[model samples]
Target: MNPTDLSLDDLDRAEAEIETGKRGMRFDQIGSFEPNAPSFLIQDVLERDSQAGVIGDSGSGKTFAVLSLAACIATGKPFAGHSVAHSGPVLYAAGEGRAGLVRRFHAWAKANGVDPLNVPLYLADRGAGLIDADQIAELRAAVRKVAQLHGVPVILIVDTWARALSGADENSAADAGQAIAVLDELRREYGGMTTLVIHHLGAADKTRGRGSTALKAALDSEFLVARNQSSTILLTATKTKDGPTPAPMAFELEDVFLKTLEDGRKVSSAWARPVEYVAESRPAGKNQSVALEVLKQLYAAQKQTLDGAGFAGREALVLVSDWRQACEAAGLDRRRFSEVKASLVDSGKVFLEGPHALLDADAVSGAASESGGTIVPPGRRTHSAMSEIGVSDAFGHFGQNPKGGR
Candidate 1:
């Protein structure tokens, strides 16, 4: 049809064709690669236009971790030493109880010294299913309205993927991919925004999310939240698409007092707080290696005993005599054993209290200890091997009765 003689229908068809062509880019039209913002939503942890999957066992503190992240992003503050590049309004769609989430948020804020009322953070009125197109659209509309009201870009955080799925088959690749697609769509519609989905870990592996592998493959990053032997929450980046994985962080759950009820009863909830990090000590030589093996054995036994008896944190203790027995069983030379024991003590891995020794529960792995505190054999303050067979076996074999010390 001639341009001037074209009917309305012909013009509409032409416009549709032109738009379709625009969707496909030519090789020359594609620009050269450039880095995304150096620090994004949560610095190296989360980037703009990205989605991350965080999974953990029940009570592993995944929800708290995400909440903390949302608060940091909303205020553009540093989270556990990591910077936040994009600070804006955060929308938390609680798949669980709204009241409970609010209480937890208050507790976290109080514990971290952040004023919750001052931050531009909002909680969704209710949860929406991810697979339903209508629900997704409705959520987007609600989020957009809220974002506009707050005068900030929206960073949507879905509390739990399973709750959003509404009993859909998470194992099915199609179902999982569709859920992830919904998250991506939200990201794209919100001006390259970030979305974080809390998930559950597989019962077997406990490393990745408990769903179709596609759910993991589709994510820009994946984090595993777990409680270590010391009952500390450990957050590790299992996978990162673009940025380098940051070091693992350890946190202790601290209870924040909320308020008193009419009956004069107090209430409180837990918040994740960063703990002091302590690096593992290394063996200096063959003698030290044997001593370390002994320490490991004794500590394992001590921890097992404490756990079996329902003890945790500072309440747990291991007798010094046990360490001495472990030393004897391992056939560690007396002089070398003393040096290794002193090193472990000086390193803060093993705390000495009277006639007992226990592992430092508050110490986080990968943290460096104070320098210039080398444990030298009593006589040999210097590096010389004062290998006298029994020249003051500093950790003398103090009787063999475990109950005696306890």
Candidate 2:
């Protein structure tokens, strides 16, 4: 063949190679690269092959908490008491202000004794909007190139998903679903690396995340960082695929200096509040018996024909309040109160009706007639005399113990 003809064949061969490369092969038994500390006492809230969402209200430190996790991964340190499987370079695509992030990173690195330069942290330049899939893909490719050159895995963080989404109205479920789909795709493409997406919670309650339920449903894990008492940040794991549930973590902000100055330099000092799990806070004192009293009151008020759903709806709160008062009057602990409430509920003495607690009307009327205008104490057996007399005159009677005594 002539030289030019051979060159043409070579070009064809190169094109064929490219096409084959583009068609990636799937691996059957992908090796398990579990971390040395496979399970984190706290971080069990997240696991390998799982996607997680971190959400909070505005100024709730959601970004800071996730950033802390990123820092820990890059430094090979444990994140919120959970050991990471891998650590290396990290990519932080800041959708907000860049200068603010730079300052924050500097302070964090200085406080934690981490060398900012050695951290291998990269920030996307402004105008490179992450909302576009193509832009995100380009960014991921660049990160992979850097990782390959440096010989380390990279964790990608998309701060504030509101800025990373395109073609979706922030308020609509359809739009949010599309945004989340794109994020899932990104995560699938970079299976080896951990991707943390920061989001916001809605005004309703903990279950309602901002934008749509699709955001929460799509994630393998979801965390909420809420501000408590205005000064404390409470980090709660709302959902996790790895385990039952994780204990909440609490943190308090304090000042810290970034560098030491020789010429009258002042190092900012702030309290270092290491992240730790907060023990469950049960209702105390009078509130301990709230559930039980609520159940009892519901049963008493609704009588024999009381429906569980309706009682639960209207009188549940009142029952709870009365129970709390009863607890204070009777001096019962929270655990005991909970047990009593559970027992009463199981016994069917009170029916719960959509937040309302209703008393069995038949039981109440029978007790009233037998006891001669007295409220019937719950779970008391009716007397033989009362059974023989019948409850025909019980309609007007009230305040009778079922045991046949006032």
Task: Work out the TM-score per prediction.
Answer: 0.63, 0.57
Tell me the deviation in Å of residue 82 in model 1.
Answer: 1.1
Enumerate residue pairs that collide in model 1: 278-364
lDDT of 2 by residue, 30-49 (tens): 46654464333124555654
| Regions of candidate 2 where Cα sits further than 4 Å from its true position | 1-43, 127-134, 151-154, 259-272, 279-406
lDDT, each prediction:
0.65, 0.55
Residue 326 of model 1, lDDT score: 55
Candidate 1 lDDT at 196 equals 80
Model 1: which ten-residue window has the lowest total lDDT? 364-373
lDDT of 1 by residue, 1-406 (tens): 2459989998788778778884333464336766454547776678877887787889888877778778888887787788887788888898787887788788888876788889888888888579887888888788779867886464788878888888689888988878888887777767867788888977654545787888778877777776754677767666666544555666788889999999999988877777754444454566555655454444444333444444423232345555665565556655455556655554445544334454444331111121111222111122222121111122223223332332
